[model samples]
Target: MSIPRDTRATVTEFLDRLAAGDPDRVAELFAEPVDWQLSWPDEGHPAIPWIRPRSTRAEVADHFRALAEHHVPERNATTVSAIVVEGGNAVLLGRIGQTARATGRSYTAMFALHLTVENGLITRYHIYEDSLSVAAALTAAPTG
Candidate 1:
C-alpha cells in the first residue's frame, strides 16, 4: 500500500517519542483533545489502573506516567513489527512486554494501535491489546 510521506513522518515521530519513554514528548505530538480508546473491560479497571480513558493531552501524559509508576522500567519493552499508514491514519502492529511492580509478575502481549494524525498532531488514539494477559500479570500471584 502506498503511504503518504507526511503521514509516515508523523507516525515515525510518534513511535520515536514512545520509544524514548517520555510521556510529555509523546503527548506533545497529540492534539489538545485526543480520542483515546483501549481494549479493556470495566471489571479490570482496578487491576490495571493505568488502563483508563483519556482525552486531553495532559491526561495522555498522565496515563503514561501512571503506567510507568506501576511497571518496572527496566522490564518494559515495546517492539513495533509493522506499521501501515494511509493519508492521516496509521496502524501499528507490535508486541509489548512489561512486569508489574506490585506483583512482580511479567506479561507479554500483542497490540494493534490505530492513530489518526491531522495537521501534524495525533487526534485519534485507539489501541487493541491482550488485556487479559496484562491483568493477569498485574493481579496474579508471583510464580517465583
Candidate 2:
C-alpha cells in the first residue's frame, strides 16, 4: 500500500515538532495507547538482550522524560537527516546531540526511528541508536 499524502504530512509534521522541542505537539501525533520501543545493540550476554519494550503513551512519555532529564537540563536536541514514508509507516534517520546536566558530558549519536501510523496518528514507534555512546556521554568522567 502506498502512503497517503496526508499521512506523509502528518509524519513530517511530527518530526518537525520533535526537532522543535515541542513535546505537546509530538504527543498530538500519537494515537491513544501508543506503543513505543527503544532497542540497543547489546554486546554482552548470549541472547544480547535489548531493553524491554514499552507500551502505552504514558510509559513512552516517561521513558523520554527520563532520558531528557538525564541528558539535557531542559531537553535534548534532535536533528533529522531524512524521512521516508510508505503506507502507514515512516522511517526517520537523524542525529541527536546533547549535554548531560548531571555529568556535564556531551554526546552525538545517529538514530533511526520507525513509526507506524493509524488514523493519522502514530500507533507504534521503534527507536534505535548507539546505546554505548549515549551511555558514555551521560555517565562519563567530567572534563575540566
Give the candidate number with the greatest lDDT. 1
In order, candidate lDDTs are: 0.85, 0.69
Model 2 clash pairs are none
Clash count (model 2, backbone only):
0
Q: Please provide TM-scores, in order, for all candidate models, with all chains considered together.
A: 0.90, 0.75
Please tell me which predicted candidate would have the highest TM-score against the true structure. Answer: 1
Candidate 1 lDDT score relative to the true structure: 0.85
Q: Model 2 TM-score?
A: 0.75
Local lDDT at 32 for model 1: 76
Error (Å) of candidate 1 at residue 36 is 0.8
Q: Can you write out model 1's per-residue Cα lDDT over 57-127, one digit (the tens) per residue?
A: 89999988888888899987778999998888999999999999989998899999999988888899999
